[model samples]
Target: MANTTSAKKAVRKIARRTAVNKSRRSRVRNFVRKVEEAIASGDKAAAETAFRAAQPELMRAATKGVLHRNTASRKVSRLAQRVKAVGA
Candidate 1:
């Protein structure tokens, strides 16, 4: 539906960006899942380690515009809380 040349190019760029963003989002999810799985298995050390790995990934996704900053901060805070609770 892009009739103009510029419009066509814009569409192409959007497609490429979408693919990249999708990949980034999936990667973030996998990192979060690792922490969740570790928590579910009740391994405090493993959960802590996974959380450590996930925290930066979450923030990085935010920095890359894949996630909102507040959303990433909230997720990190909640995950850290859960990881800490694993020891209690």
Candidate 2:
């Protein structure tokens, strides 16, 4: 119900932003999932590699405003710990 022209334009912008954010969020989740799957498979080297890939994706998501900085950092820290534990 955007009656004003500016309001309509704003709605359109929001829709586009929503789609982009959705894709970004999905990409982040997929990256995290890859790391988790590698960890679950008990392949230390593969898990480490996946973690390396995921860490940057998580931070990039935060930089793009898809995730909070602390949240991203926390996830990276926890995943790193899990990856480390895999070898031990």
Candidate 3:
């Protein structure tokens, strides 16, 4: 479908970017899931630890344009709340 040489190169670049973004998204989800699982299991320490690890990953994804800034902030805020609640 990409008839022009430049269009073909652009398609290749898009494919590469898509793969990278997909991997980043999946990594972020795993980090979030770890925190959520820790919270659900009622392990305050583990939840806090997981939240600490996930916070930077979430922000990194946002900075790299894998996620929106507000979306990452909201996720971090909600996870922190849940982690706090786990302690109470």
Candidate 4:
């Protein structure tokens, strides 16, 4: 129900951005899940590997605006601590 062409274009852009953001968010969540699963399984090496893999994804989510930087850092920090404890 956008009367102006600019508004119509904004709606279209938002729709496209939403789809992209959804995919990014899903991918980040998947990485986080993988790390958590590895930790739950008590595989220290696997957990470390998964954490390593997830770090970049989480940071990317923050850098790309899908996640807040502090939130992403907190998640990474917690995940790293968990991995360290498991590895220790």
Clash counts per candidate, in order, are 0, 0, 0, 0
Give TM-scores for every candidate, taking all chains together and pairing residue i with residue i: 0.98, 0.98, 0.99, 0.97
Report every candidate's CA lDDT.
0.97, 0.97, 0.98, 0.96
In model 1, the Cα lDDT at residue 36 comes to: 97
Which tens-of-lDDT digit does each residue in 4-83 have in candidate 4? 99999999999999999999999999999999999999999899899999999999999999999999999999999998
lDDT of 3 at 68: 99
Poorest 10 consecutive residues by lDDT, candidate 1: 79-88
lDDT of 3 by residue, 1-88 (tens): 9999999999999999999999999999999999999999999999999999999999999999999999999999999998999978
Which residue pairs collide in model 2, if any? Answer: none
Cα lDDT tens digits, model 1, 1-88, are: 9999999999999999999999999999999999999999999999999999999999999999999999999999999999999888
Query: What ranking emerges by lDDT with the best candidate at the front?
Result: 3, 2, 1, 4
Off by over 4 Å in 1: none
Of 1 and 4, the candidate ahead on TM-score is 1
lDDT of 2 by residue, 7-31 (tens): 9999999999999999999999999
Q: List the residue pairs that clash in candidate 3.
A: none
Candidate 3 regions off by >4 Å? none
lDDT of 4 at 88: 66
Cα deviation at 48, candidate 1, in Å, is 0.9
Model 3 residue 52 CA deviation in Å: 0.4
